[model samples]
Target: MSTDTRAAAPEVRISGIDPHWWRQAAVYQIYPRSFADADGNGIGDLQGIITRVPYLAQLGIDAVWLSPFYPSALADGGYDVDDYRDVDPKIGTLEEFDQMVAALHAEGIRVVVDIVPNHSSDRHEWFRQALAAEPGSPERERYIFRDGTGPEGAEPPTDWTSIFGGPAWTRVPDGQWYLHLFAPEQPDFNWANPEVRADFLKTLRFWSDRGVDGFRIDVAHALTKDLTDPLPSEAELDAIPRDAGQHPIWDRDEVHEIYAEWRRVFDSYDPPRTAVAEAWVERHRRPRYASAEGLGQAFEFDLLTQEFDAAAFKDVVVDSLSLAAESGSSSTWVLSNHDVVRHATRYGLPPLPETVGTTEQDRKQGAAWVLAGAPEDQLDREKGERRARAATLFELALPGSAYLYQGEELGLHEVGDIPDEARQDPTFFRSPGVDKGRDGCRVPLPWSSTGLTFGFGSSSAHLPQPQWFADYAVEAQERVDGSTLEMYRAALHLRRELQTDETLEWIETGRDDVLAFRRPGGWVTVTNFGEDDAALPSGEVLLASSPLVGGRLPGATTVWLRESQS
Candidate 1:
């Protein structure tokens, strides 16, 4: 660590003393089912994570964000929680979870667990009780239950569609319908109900008391809904301005009050537990979720959907920093997660239109090409890997926190060929041919180059792993110099040493395809997105994503430079 402590702003020093340690931390997301399997059960468990705590600490990440490990029905990939307070037996027991937390804490790493408050699994005790209860009862009031809108109550109450694809409302035996924003197995909670609010606060305190460091709130923005009689239709929602608190079922003002109450629970902790919202609201509404009085940080998801273009990358970076400054919170950068295609493979596909994911045609094409597997001839794998490397360097150099998904360190690509019979994502079943769902990115990671499932476990993995995964296995990449795994390790180690105050100054080169910026600590980062080489700034070369072209920065490359000692 550098002894020079002087800084212009509240610097993100890699020290345990900093209360706001997450500001510049690198968090690694570990999907429990795909990360590692310790019990030969073809599923990654808390015990497996315990065995790999040394690996996480060695990766130089400050925190590990574990996806939902709660008892679930496996609907929507664990987003449908059956219990808020216990670990799923298929993954591990509560004692094993505590052991995993202790192991991580012993290694100087923080533990952040996922909290799914928006909905619960249909098998959840409360949901089951609600199902058995009669209409207009207090149990039913805990969820969004309404009478049908048509003759003989035969139609859905609203025109809203489930995110997994289908009607959001599911009719029960009592001739009443309940709302589920995701799959039918996951019912949305009635946030207006005091029981829902009180229960979530208890969940927060439960994990915090167990020494959990932070939380990743699933579906953070869509919790509170304005269930006015004669609810707004899809067309009516489209006509409404995209402002906070205006929409009927999304980004309403009441959502913030929930977060406000949760923030109080967070503050009650010793160092004050932190949280990040997985909200997909517009950039303008993002700050509301990220406010210090709320969830503390909101995921900047625009970067994940963007093409590997210099101009587009720069725009999102600038916009995120500005928003973070206004909100008095740090911004988050994540390229890939369990929900989307891995960037390593995504960058290889053809560029999407400017308004990506906004149109039905674009989304359908994306699912077909990116998720359903485009022909091998259409993909430029080598090019995509190179861009992926450059993008990681660019993202790590930015001001705030960075999130790395599991298997990304080894440069893993999407496993798009999982047989339909083995597919488990609800999106696949719900949407049929329209969407392939997210199982491609959630495949078990390859730890070694040998074995039937690339050493994922004693038995085959729950999701099949391509044989080519052997090439990018952690064991193989560890030995190869300049591999993606090594590059990530070096970047993370260097980031702590070279980082300065939370400041980003644009370095103008008068080139549209080049993006150059300097931090206050004489550290400079340059990324070239054109077909031509670009000149490097005057500084000592610290690291490069790829080899330089005759000492010039090559296209689709990123380089880190530091002020040379005279």
Candidate 2:
């Protein structure tokens, strides 16, 4: 490993440590339940992940971010954590987790685990104790418990609604209501409580001491709430203003203190651990989460939400890079994750609305409409695949860290045909039949063309796999040249040599459809998002998302070019 440490801003570096590993590294997210299954129990586990470490190393990702594998009741897909220090019995034992970490280190891949600090599983011991204890007790004080309004306390304490659906406040037998922003199984933690803060710090040290590289802090912005202020109406919550740190429940100024202390904990380690906040705040407010004394990075989600237009992509990228530079933190780019629709299917649809509908009802309706209309026949699958490949190349070529969700390298599309009975996301259940939820993107990945579960395991998967998945299986794609899998491998391998710059220089491509930019080392990348072919710059072809049309870049394709010597 190179020991040369270059001076960067405090938010981007840790004293003498070299922070380049995470700054430009390509990290792969493994949603353990759907990644691979080893025990034939129809669920993916830590053992399954250990079995696949070599595969991840082969894919060339510098690190792997494993989603929550903690003990939980599976409510809200394990975000409700019953235990922070131990692994879920279904996943594996603590001993197995240590072994997996060692194995991944041996393969030169770091491990980042999910940490859900905003809420604990309703089944968590503290929550259980709160349930049995009287209101106003220390156990109950750990959570956001408040007295209900109206006669006999019939009304909830506030008008807030759960992000999943229904009222955010759940009334207990004692007539006091507890706040749960997500599913009722997840009771929001009261960060005001000293115990809650201390416990989470302990959880952080437990993992870091065990060799975990970092944490993807779930609901990082929602940890601190302003109870003194009136709860925002459902409408206000729906259309949250971009104003910085003024919201009652979402992104508040107090959240930084928690992260500042966490940063100190990370800095104490021999090789300081890192953290990336899964904060959904506005672009302006996101920097605070990654400020000098806070977390190292925050997810820059503009690319994930933007349309496929070149102008729009350029604007988002430029804005994100600018914001990160201001905070002295590297921007974290991600296309898709367990929460949203897969970009492959998203790109296939007609141009998305500039803003998703304001109300939850409208948003769900719009999502259902898109999913229903996005069949292979209605969508240009060939065009979608091309654009997806091009988008991946564009994202990886940028001068910052990039995240790849599992199976995206294989070009998997959203499984829109998943049976209603098989849907597991809490949003789907909370909303009844109104929304289909995110199970479409969480379906078990296909590893082989022929198997009981496509080599996911010997038994059937927890979620049904569609027959069409056979075509995109790793076995088939590995054998084909110019496949999406190969494109990803080659692009990742080449990215290491090219992504040495921390800044991006936009090259005027003249055409609105062509987005062009230059990185360090005379490397340039161009993506043609228009309907017609775009002229390529004079250079040697380093890589192309698709074959060029008569030596010209075709629409919906991206190419990496190295400036040639005269």
Candidate 3:
């Protein structure tokens, strides 16, 4: 096959075709604290992101999902939002946020900010008022403040445990207890209060009016809780059943009502702004969050949680597509994010069990084992990189939208050895030696091989980068052919031109270790997960994650092929 023939795949312009571009667009997630820092403050800021708009535009992503930069005490990594209407001074001012949004718009990239509607920072004015007000006061109605049960009101209101490993209820100085599903610094809102619902709608409009495109709702499933019900014991909380019906705090049916109201607000806009829920509900219940009246999209996290196996990947993709079809919405795909270990290192770990149990102890033990085993010296870097590239090709070739984390394109591994003293993740202190937390995946990105902070900024990054990051620096990889960064750029460029808005069709290769699928445009993607090389289908190779061996797809590799017309 000639190079010209391989490069002759059809090209389609996807930008201006439909107002609902998010249905098929690829979105890049930017963790502002580690993405870039312009003012030499050692923390990434809005200006730093503005400086990189060109980089994102060239990468071919349709939108940028900015994690929470709201004013906060830095508890829970900005998820404890004190002010929803403004940006944190450490990140940038509101004026800088508007400027950044305008710059991103100029580059044809949409901006999706994170919204933490389920909780507010304890420092928030409302929470402060609630703390100062007497019991049963109106000011206390904004949050979930309950009277304790035991003598002298010393006992907690319930037996619920926090997601971060402590009691969910915190006793106030006034003999009352308050609910905080996450950290104590983040107080759960009383959604039953009309004021809370009205305020969130106002916040949504505030950003949308300023040209924000959408929102990636934080804890989308936990906003509405059944406070009337008794709290489950620690064991029951840990083993919360994954069913469609209501639970004490998660995936309650009332949560959809909040989204439905938000959807109406989205529809009120000129372009109909979009939203994606970060809901970890049962598969059957997940579709409800993306129904026609609900948010238009929700993160399908099965792909992120699955083992690096052909069968597992195939199952998640098919199931997600089916769910999207049923819900009259689009599927969203992601492999890595700020909250989890980087997929490159994760792929290097041993195969995981098919079904993880519901017990908290079981889950914690499993996670600890994975984290403890992922030391840099213990990982198979070569094999991991091969699989990571193959996985990227496989994910981007799928039908629906894809999400790329900050450093995945560089094939960066988790920084497993972050110093104990420098660690900042709440999970680290909350779990204390049992789990390492998510700082490994949140390290600052490397833009240059030689710099104070690898070109992330003039000052050292807040989170330390491993010495080996120089090998994956953007400047170094841009010059090396077949580098991971270049591979991502090429895959994204081709995805825009050759991808179709069609469902995937599996092509049987009679091999359990291989996944082969054909898209609408005579384009076929094949991934080999076996020990031996697999025979390639008869087609012109448009792209490959790794070099093919004797016209055979090598193990831990993927290839995009265009069926020959003649």
Model 2 Cα RMSD, 1 decimal: 5.4
lDDT to native, each model:
0.85, 0.85, 0.85
Predictions: Cα RMSD each: 6.1, 5.4, 7.4
Q: lDDT per residue, candidate 1, 118-170, as tens digits?
A: 88999988889998999999999999999998898989988888777889999
Candidate 3 runs further than 4 Å off:
1-17, 236-242, 353-366
Backbone N/Cα/C clashes per model: 0, 0, 0
Ranking by lDDT: 1, 3, 2
Residue-level lDDT tens digits of model 3 in 1-566 = 00111121122222463567888888999999999999999999999999988889888888899999988888788888988887789989877887888788777788889999999999998999898999998889999988887798799977877888788999999789999989999999999899899988988888887878889999888888777746566677657675855777788888888888999999997688899998877788888888869988888878877777889898889899999999989889898888877889878877545455323344444455567744556678788888989999999999888988999999999888889998988878888887888888899999999978999999989999988999999999985789998889989989989876758899999899999999988999999987799999999999999999898999999999998887
What TM-score does each of the candidates earn?
A: 0.95, 0.94, 0.94
Q: Give every collision pair in model 2.
A: none
